[model samples]
Target: MREVDHIEQLVGKLLLLVTPLEDRRLHTDLHNFTHQLSCDRISYSAAALFHIDRSLLTSCIAAIAISIYLVILVEFGLPSLTTSVNNAYGVPNLSEISSYFVCIVMNMYFFVIYLFDIDSTLQGPQKTHTLLSLSLWTGLMVLRLVILAYSSEMVVQEASRTQRLVTKLQMLPVPASSGCQEELLLFEEQLARSPLHYSAAGFFALDLSLLKSFVAAVTTYLVILVQFQIPDTNKE
Candidate 1:
């Protein structure tokens, strides 16, 4: 919610800080778009995969860091090629080296994706810009599933327990005229109608635990892949 507030402030500044001396038509269009934007809360989702919230940026960067780890594993951990084909060429096979380089390059590229994903909040009029934003949005959403998972049911259970505890506290003895009781009641009422979480197509809720699960899953699979490949490479 605070992130949304910062986005509103940014839109406000862009609209208010424009100069009349600049390209007049572009400025007018920007003002109009920014005005429309300021009036509503914008939500970005990627086809039920994940939300385009600030946390997503962090998750993406972490995933890229994991990929970098994979690249290092491939470079130093995997045995080198030992095929007769290499002897014929009299040149060291550079495919693994090239792939490691590509991974490094792509890690930087993913950061660019993260930047543009954040930029999507500041939407514009161009169709191309919108398409680019959605593309990045989709990519990240898919990444969320590929790199993470969590039991939404666990989160829902904990939240329900916490809410119950809070409501029960309101029953505690307190000064009759104290504002604390009134504030607690108001808070309870406000939360009563709202579900305690956000889910993906009703399948499960999203939370930080999901990111942890994703990292763990990726690591396990990578280790298995390396273990299986080592024997095959040894035989070769």
Candidate 2:
């Protein structure tokens, strides 16, 4: 609860910082004098794909989860973990799929920005710097979450594999294998004692709750795959 409160406080501070940038005419003279550019009606965008604003933060979060979902589908297969859907699934060309999907997703985001006139709200020279700051902060947060998610997943997998290996080792009939079994037991104990985690610049550590959120995101991705009707094929 205290962690949540801390995050809330941080967000409140960021909102306070963004308040000044929201005013399009706030830094007009400064921008013109320093940047030799017009501060009036200046638009903000990222690589010409989508405008930079609060909506961008939401778009980025969605994009990250979608990207993760697509990766899982291509690498781990949908509806099952054992199957690989890369070559045996929809979209004839496996190599170009990612590029094509990225293009489509970007355009979709562009359409959303246009449909809602989000860019019009951010007109001003200072808006660019504001957007950049927000983008940087959001990117860092996303990186932290991704690292924590994957790290936790790896730890879980490793623990399960080690447990299985130890179970198998203990069933061995040969007494010479006793030493190997003991070593496996010790390793398992170590794993149990110190679980894996990820941190952001020594600020905070990711834990089980973050892992749950990551899993939920992955689940949402699966739903997206189903909605898109990801091609499933049999190569054999």
Candidate 3:
């Protein structure tokens, strides 16, 4: 989000720097403005943005670990553990009870990838609250991811908006100096040639569709692990 804000500010500065008409009669300072925008601030911004904390690579690693751990624990661990417990004592199998605990941990994880898995929550009649809580936390994670993507998306939106404004300015029927026209044309070309995007290094674009990809990856791995698990009867 901070990166998005910074890029928008740079683009905004560019737009402001280029949009003014230079009238020699009025003794305007238009000439120096372009140099400041193109040299000092833009160079600094490019240096800062070139390595955005390794961008989404860090995010993908953490998200994959959390998602895979939670799904596998919920789908496989609880049921297997439940059958191992001695239910003859009239105690609720730990399967459902464990899921409740996962729910509790999930709440913490959202505020902090400090999250966890479940088995006790699936612990029979108590499963509802725990299951709902897990779902809610997962939903919150989805929301957080979407917000980040949307924030980055604003850079593109702002760039497009700036381009439109520049084009419209160029089409005006009034007489314009060559410098002003050249500035607009240069900025337009830059915008076209260097479109803004967010991604995991260069693997995939960081958009709403990223959520679907994450889910698909987790599900695929879970299935692969389950398929390769050794059955107790077969082991004998």
Please, what are the lDDT tens digits per residue for candidate 3 over residues 76-178?
Answer: 5533443343333113313322343344344433322212221222344455565566567766665665675576567658768977987896675422322
What value does the lDDT take at residue 172 in candidate 2? Answer: 55
- TM-score-based ranking, best first? 3, 2, 1
Task: Provide the lDDT at 104 for model 2.
Answer: 37
lDDT of each: 0.52, 0.47, 0.50
Best by TM-score: 3
lDDT of 1: 0.52
Q: What is the model-wide C-alpha lDDT for candidate 2? A: 0.47
User: Mind giving the per-residue lDDT tens digits that candidate 1 earns over 71-173?
Assistant: 5433433223212222333222133223333443344343343444522333345635645655565466545443323444465567577568768967865
- Using Cα atoms with residue i matched to residue i, what is each candidate's TM-score against the true structure? 0.25, 0.29, 0.41
Collision count for each candidate, in order: 2, 1, 14
Winner of 1 and 3 under lDDT: 1
Candidate 2 lDDT over 24-100, as tens digits, reads 45445333343332223345776665776777678657546645654554334422432222224324322232343
Better structure of 1 and 2 per TM-score: 2
Tell me model 3's lDDT, rounded to 2 decimals.
0.50
